[model samples]
Target chain A: MTGLLDAAFVLLILTTLVLLGSSRIRLGIRVLAVQGVVVGAAALLLPNHHVTLRVVVIVLIGTILDAVVFPILLLRALRTARVERETDPPVGYTASILIGVGLLTACLWGMKYGGITLPHEGANPLELPVAAYTVLAGLFLIVARNNALNQILGYLMLENGIFLAGLSTAMEVPLLIEMGILLDVFIMVMVMGVALFHISRTFDSIEVGGMTALTDWPDQEDVGK
Target chain B: MIAGLILIPLVAAGAAFAIRSHPVRRAMLVSVAAVHAALTARLWVDWPARPAPVLDGWLAVDAPGLLFLSTCSALFLAAAVYAVGYHAREDVGEPRRDIEEGGLFFRNEPEAVFAGCMLLFLGSMTGVSLSQHLGLLWVGVEATTLATAPLIYYHRHHRSLEATWKYLLICSVGLALAMIGNFALAASIPRAEAESGRINLVLGDLLANARALNPAWAQIAFVFFLVGYGTKMGLAPLHTWLPDAHSEAPSLVSALMSGALLNCAFLGVLRGHQVCTAAGFPGFSSELLIWFGLLSMAVAAVFILGQTDFKRMLAYSSVEHMGILALAVGCGAAYGMGLHALGHSLIKGSLFLTSGILLAAYQTKNVTKIHNLLADYPVTGLLWLAGFLAITGAPPFSLFLSEFTVGKTLLDADRPVAAAAYLVLLGVIFLGMASAVLPMVHGTGPVDHEPAGGQSAPPGYRPPLTMLVPPIVLAGAVLGLGLYLPVDVREVLRDAAAALSGGVSP
Candidate 1:
């Protein structure tokens, strides 16, 4: 079981990299769905945690939010916007992939050399670094993608990463907060979908870069200076 | 009573949604505001006789919480008055853009939704002020964002829509980071203590066990909490959404957002500082706070100088005052900081409300296109300049007294360099503010009185008395408190200050 957990953790991270590198929007969503399932399974595998009914329920809720509800929301937004691919990302695909790898490497290297350890003596080293990488990767997605749909995907990715880390590290995290966080994430994504539809309607596309009408430097002489 | 404070606004919000009549909904909004303000005042007066209870460690009202609660209610009540007046004028449908070529038409917003969300925002902010548990506090903070996002999109124009998107996405992201910070905080507790079932985010419990927390994780948690809440507070580099949100939202909403909402976020930061102080890491938090504070001030000064829109200018001014509030908190002069927060709120709230009047008169946000408020709308023009002066920390305003307290604290702490820098920043900000205000208030087109939507205002047109009174009342509060600090208000400040400094109010 421990071996499987280790493999699942690495696979979860591998899927995140795929999320970072993949240009097909559908493929990214599928990769994220797999990552979500793996994270849920891994939540059950955290060492020393009593697998109570509450934990099981939380895992179920989180899984549904991550793997099921989110992807549907993203797909609806994407279809409404009629965009199927993530193209002309702010950072190039190769560069974003490199950045993801760099973030993972930094987290691993910091864990080893930076004297970082959880307050709990037996806390597993694998979860924190992987979770950190996932977060950074999500941030990269949001920053690099100009499409509104893609940005929403990135935000969901970010929340998922936080959930994985929070659940694994903080045993005292009450069931109430876990449920609240899940609900907040779901509503946030739903709102983003509404906004994406509006964006598509208003700008004729869901491209975030098209939002140049409202800006600080409006005059031509110093528009961006 | 505490429950009533939270529930009243919420029930009003529900009723607001259910109501179909616009006047009825508007009346409900103001009535709720009045009741809230009254409750807060009663609570403030009765604090000593009947202290707030901590209910199962989930919710408690302490001195600082009451201070914040009162300020939120007071500022909100003033803004509520202005909102009713604002909608009255807005119903006249001023020209959406410049009064040329018949102008652009903005999409109509649902009045019920707007009214409902405003009340919901009030309830959520009240929740933030009273919440003692970290998770519940997080809920309130996030709810404030959710409630206020629609308020920002009230105009339903391209700009308001964009601002709404930014406000929602960015604040949600910031709050997600805060949740992770909370997780880190829980993780930092000693394993034995945590396992002993004393491992929650109840403010008192966390402070009690602060000594045993892992230093490394505690520092990590503090950083995330600061960055996360700081984003909401509109601190430098994290304030990207502020100007857009404030400028695009109705001026009344901007008033509440600046005067009332920012303080709630600042309370979250103060809670972060409280934990740091408890953990014997005051230096760490203080240094970061001061730096973020100065950086915010500097960034705001630059933007205010370049800013052309009057509402956006007020937004940047909000950023500057948030910085000063941060600086005061960092300086550990709890009394001074709380006072400064109050003063800034009174002055800033009035200023934003005044901005709404200016917008109504000129029908444009551009400072270049507006001139001679003294020549045109006399009351609003005079109030505009007065608010500008008051906000810039000029003498004869309450802001001067509070700002001075912070500067004295910095000097007493032997940070003369910081004190001097703070002063210099204030000067630069004043200059920047003056350049924008002088022309708007004193310069001479017989400034644009052609009300947008092709509504005509006669030459001697003045803003309605209801629209005029709220800001005048706020300005009086600012100037009055400057002249005389009542013993009652002073006592409240002292108790709240002590509470923030890790000493339970005596």
Candidate 2:
């Protein structure tokens, strides 16, 4: 079980790096879906003394939402917005890949040196570090990408990272709360997808860089009349 | 009983969606708001003492929550009444021409969507106030973000679309971190407690087990909570979405966001602070809040200094008052924070409502272009001037009392320098806001006061009583509270403040 979990963690890291390096939105979505599936698998594989029917059911629903439902939504948005690839992110793909690797290394080092240890000694050692790396990489994706769709992808990565972090912890959140969290995430993605449609229609492009009509620069155009 | 408080509006929201007639939908909005307010008032009377946790300790009517809940309920009623008049002017069920896009026509979002979202927004805020479990509170806060996004996009223009996008994305991300904070908090439980399945994120359970918590994880949770909820609360450095959303959203939505939604988020932050205090780490959270509060105030002061747009300027003022709330809580002035929260909400809600009237009359938000407001619209202009005085902490308004409470606490704590900085920032903000507001209210009207291409007020336009009464009533409440807080209200404020301060002081 530990070996399978470690393999899942490795897959999560590889997928995150691939996501950072890929410019094709479609391909990026695929990598994110794979990462989501691995994360769901990891939730089950974690060494738990008691794994009930509830856990299995939640894992199934979560996998479907994160992997299948989310990607389908993003793909529909992609086709409707009529964009194929990220043309010019503020940060290049190579630098982004390097940055992802650096973040992964930093997370490993920090966990090892920072004396961060889970209460359950039998928990996999790699869980915390990998979760931290995924979170940072997700945040970096959000900041470095210019497309609204890419940012939404980044937000999903961030959410997935948080989910993994919970699995790493010893705490037992109630199933109801877990479901509430998942439902909130589901609605959130739907809202963002709808907003993306409006952005594309109103601006003729999904580049957030062009959506600079609202700003606080001292000399910006007056918004009054 | 508390479940009904949350369910009534949510169920009404579903009804609003199914209803066909716009007038009927609007009536539903107002009637539900009135019922919600009456129920909230009934809460005070029924539990004249203290109410126990309802729903298996998942929801409770505590001092701080009640204060916030009442404020939200009152403000929603005011916004609901004001919305009726505003929407009538807006010509619901008709495709409105886009003024920003040079005569291009854009259909307004369905009035049903607007009313439904507003009701949903109210229900979520109610959930936020009543939630005793951190996870439930987080759900409530996120729901508010979702419910209000459609409201902000009601106009269907590019700018509002942009505002809605920014608001939805930024707040969603921020609340995600807050979810992580909830996990961290669960992790902070002692191993024994975890093994016993006592790891739910309920406030009472967490506080009871505070001494056994791992301080390291507890502190980590507070940081996440501060950043996450602070982003929603419009604390500076994380307040990028605020001005745009507030300025661009229809003014009634702006009023609700500024007046009510921000308080719900602040309550989230304070809940985290309560846990930290129970965990014997008050100093850590206090230091962080004080610094963040000062930073927010400083940021608001700078932007407000020369702001030309009246709505954005009011948005910045909301940021500044949120700072004062944080600072007061940090200084252990819970009573003052409660008083200030009440005052600021009513004053700011009235101000935003009045700004809508001004917008209707002038068709412009630029303060420079608005002249002779007092001459043109006496009631709105008087309300605007009074709101300015109240918000800026002028004498005999609740804001003045609240600011003074914060200042006195700072001085009492031997933090003279912090106290001085607080005063200096307030002074600068007062000057900044006064310059913009006074000119708009009292400026002499030139021959061509209207901006180029600005449409004159709709022919024979007179401010409807519904539009005028809410602000007057809101501002009037602030004046009354400032002059004399009723004994029960004073007791509630003190209790709320004491709850936040861990009963250290009244």
Candidate 3:
């Protein structure tokens, strides 16, 4: 079980690296789907987790929504929006992969030397560090990428990271509350998809870099400094 | 009963979508708002006499919750009333030109979506106020973001679209971080508690056992909670989406966002603070809050100094007041913070509604282009001026009392340096806002300034009574509170303040 969990974590980390370096939206969604499944399965592999009907249902629902549902939604959105790939992200792919490596290294280093421990004494040590790395990677994806679909993918990755952390750390989260969290995530992704569709429709592009009409800075000519 | 308070609006939101008639939906909106307010008032009036039981420890109305809940209820009522007037003006067949993209035209989104989202926003905020479980509270906060995204996109234009996207994505990401914070909070439980296999997020349970919580995990939880909810609360460096969202949304929606939604987000932070305080860890959270607070104030002041759009200026002012709320709590003036939250909500809600009227009459949001307000529209002009005065901490308003209380509390706490900085920031914000507002309210427009909207309202047009009354009523309430916080209200505020700093978390 421990080996399985470690393998899942490795897969999660590697997929994040692939996501960071990839510009192809389809490939990104596929990688995210794989990552999501690994995270959902990793929930079951957490040490001391009681395998019950409710937990199984939640994990099943979570895995299906994250792996199959979200990807299909994004692919549909991608098709409708008529965008093929992420174009001209603020950060380059090679640099992004390097940054991902750096983020993973930092997390590993921090876990080793930073006196970090789970609330429960017997929980797996790899869970928190991997979770932290995935979260940072997700946030980096959102910030560094200019594409809306890519950002949504980043958001889902972030959600997956949080879900993993929640499963490991908050062992006693109520089944109903877990359902609520999953439902919220589902609605959030739907909302983002619709909003993305609207953005593409209105701006004729889904690039967030074009959103410059609203700002606080005084125009240069008006400031005349 | 608490469940009903949350469920009623949610059901009405569904009804709003199903209903065909626009007027019926609007009527239902107001009726729901009124009922929610009445029930909230009953919580104050009747429940104290015979205390109600918590619903399975999932939802409960404590002092701070009730206070914030009351504020939300009251503001929702005001915004609901104001929205009727707004839609009456806007929902016509007029193809309003998109101001951001010149020469492009747009129409309002479906009335069902707007009305449904409004009620849904109310429902979600109610959930936030009543939630006794941290996980439930996180759900409520995220639901609020989802509910209001459509409301922000009500105009169905590129700018509103962009604003909606930013609001949806940024807030959702922020809230995801908050979920991580929730996990960290759960992790703060002692191993003994964890071994019992009943590690729940019920506030009372956590508060009872806070002393045994792991300090390291508690610190981590507090950081994530602050950053996560702070982003939603419009603290500086994370407030990037606020101005755009507020300005793009309809004025009534902006009012609700500033006055109600932000307070609910702040309440999320306050809940985290309550837990940390119970766990004997106040210094860490307090220091971080004060820094974020000062940064928000400084950011607001700079933006307000150069703000061109009137609506965005009000949004920035909200960030400033949220900062004040944070600062007051950091300084241990929880009592004053309670009053400040109420006063700020009422005043800011009124100001945004008044800005709606201004937007209608002038067809422009630019401060310089809008002129002769006192001469052109005396009532709106007075309300506008009153909002400016009240919000800037002028005498004869509750904000004055609250701001003074907070400053005095800081001084009494032997934090003269912080007190001075607080005062200095307040002074700068006042000046900055006045420079923008006074001219807009009292100054003249350029000689060649012709109203720009393709279908501008006629000169000397007056807003209907429905629109004018809500702001006047809200502003009047703030004034009345400033003059004399009735015994019952003051008592409630005191209880709320105590709840913030109470030895046990409420």
Candidate 4:
């Protein structure tokens, strides 16, 4: 079980790198799908003491959402917007990959020095470090990407990281409560999907940087100043 | 009965998507508001100034929850009423025709989506108030964000699209952090106890075991929760999405977002504060809130000074008032914060509604472009000017009483600096807002004036009666609350404040 967790963690890290290096929205999303599958596998492969029928059910639903439903929605949004590939992001692919490595090193360093240990031994040692990496990489993607689609992908990665952390803690939060939170995210992506369609329709592009038109910068009154 | 709050809105939303007629959808929206308000009133009359579960221990109306529910129900009804009247404009009544980019364009408004989302948004808010479980509360608040995201793009223009994108992205990240915060709060439970299967996210359970829970872990958790929920509440530094969202969203939607949603998000902060207070470190959470509150006020004051758009000015005022509510809550004046929220909602909701009226009549949101409001539309102008006064915490208004109580509480807490800063920021806001509003409300009409939007109404144009009356009704409610706090209300406020400040009950 521990070995499986380690392999899954490595897969998750490699997927994050793929997301950072990829320019095609389609490939980026496919990488995200694989990452989601890895997260689900980690849960299902949990040591017998930590596994439950409800956990299995949740991982199934989560897999469907992160892998199947979300990709279709993003693809539909793409078709509606009539675009296939993302423009070069604000952070170059090379730099973002380096940032990914930096994030992993920092996460491991923090765990070693920062001493944020659990009250007991965690389910897997790599869980915390992998979760931290995914979260930081997600934040980086959100900030460094120019495309709205990439931002959404980043958001999904953030959720993935948080999910990883929870499983590692083996916290006893109920299946029902977890489902309720997941439903909120489900609706959230759906709403953002609709907004993305609307945004692409209006601006004819989904570039986050193109949002400066509505700002209060050098207010209309202070334009000359 | 408690379940009805969540179910009714969901049902209405479904009906809204099914029913295609514009007027019926509008009626459905307002009817849900009415029923929701009636349900809230029943609960208010029955519930005491303490926490008690009514729905199998999953849902409860406590003091703070009741306070927010009342504010939510009232503003929702008022905003819906204003939406009904505002729909009579060309944008809603028929397909809009425009010669844009040198071509003829026509498009029908999505009335059903707008009306349905508003109903669902109200339900999400009510769910937040009635929920006793922290996970449920997070779901409820996040649902509110999702439900209202589409409503921000009601006009379906480039600017509206931009606003919706920013609103969704910034808030989603903020609330996701909040979810991580929830995880942190959960992790604070002792590992042995948690693994032994005694973990519960119910507010009561968490509060009961707070001292046994890890304080350091909870404190760190509380920080994440603050930033996450604080973004939704529009606290300074986390409030970048607010001004655009408020100013771009239709007036009625703006009213709900400012008047209700910010308070709903504040309820999350209050829950975290409750746990911290229980953990024997009341000062830790309270200090965090005070610094954030003060920073929010200063930021709001700076923005309000040079704000040109009336709607945007109202948005910044929301940030300022949200700052006031934070300060009030942090200083241990739960009663005052509750009243301040109620007073602020009524006054500000009316102000936003009247701003809608201004939009309809003057055809521009730009402050300088608006003139002779008092003469051109007497009912709207009086409500607008009165709302501005009431919102600025003038006497003979409920806002004054709440602001005074909040300030007095701050002084009593021996935070003279915070109290003084509160007063000073309020003064700055008033002067700045007065600089924009006074001229618009006082000036006589300028003949042959060119409208900023190129679609200004005739000088004597009158909006529908529905639009004018909601603000009038809201302004009156503000008056009633100022002149008298009913015995039941006073009990609720006192109890609610006591309850929020980590007391058991009366």
Record all residue pairs in model 1 with backbone atoms less than 3 Å apart, i.e. clashing: B94-B452, B94-B453, B95-B452, B95-B453
Tens-digit lDDT string for candidate 2 (A1-225): 888888999999999999999999999998899988999999888774357787777678778988888889889999999998998999999999999999999999999999877766587788889988888898899989999989988988987888778766733667533745465565557588788988999889999877777876635665423
Task: Please write out the lDDT profile of model 1 over residues A1-225, one tens digit for every residue.
Answer: 678779888898888888888888888888888888998898888774779897888888888877998788777777777878867888988998899999999999988788877666556778788888888788889989987777777887887788778777676656534745554674556567677777788777887776665666777532210
Deviation (Å) of B399 in candidate 4: 1.6
True contacts kept of each: 0.52, 0.55, 0.67, 0.49
lDDT of 4 at B327: 82
The best candidate in terms of DockQ: 2
- Estimate, for each residue in B1-506, the C-alpha lDDT of model 2 and write its tens digit: 78888999999999999999888999999999999999999887765565666878889888899999999999999999998999888864667666444665667788888899999999999999999889889888988988999999988888888888889878888887887788788788887777687756788788777888889888888999999999999999999999999998999999999999999999999999999998898999999999899999999999999998899999999999999999999998888999999999999999999999988877777787776677778888899999999999998998999999899999999999899999999999999999999988887746565546543333345879999999999999999999999988888887887778782212
Question: Candidates 1 and 3: which is better by DockQ?
Answer: 3
Docking class of 4: acceptable
Q: Write candidate 1's Cα lDDT for B184-227 as tens digits.
A: 88888887777777767788888887887888888888888888
DockQ of 1: 0.54
Cα lDDT of model 1 overall? 0.82
Question: lDDT tens string, model 3, A8-47?
Answer: 8999999999999999999999999998899888888888
List candidate 1 segments past 4 Å from native: A221-225, B50-54, B92-103, B445-461, B503-506
**Candidates 2 and 4 compared by lDDT, better number:** 2
Q: What DockQ does each listed candidate score? A: 0.54, 0.58, 0.56, 0.47
Cα lDDT of model 4 by residue, A1-225, tens digit: 678777888898999999988888888888898898998897677552356777777788878878888888877777777666776778998999998999999998987687676555544556667787888899888988989988988988888887776665535766433744476466546787777777777677888777775655435432210
Comparing only chain B with the true structure, the TM-scores of all models are 0.94, 0.96, 0.96, 0.94
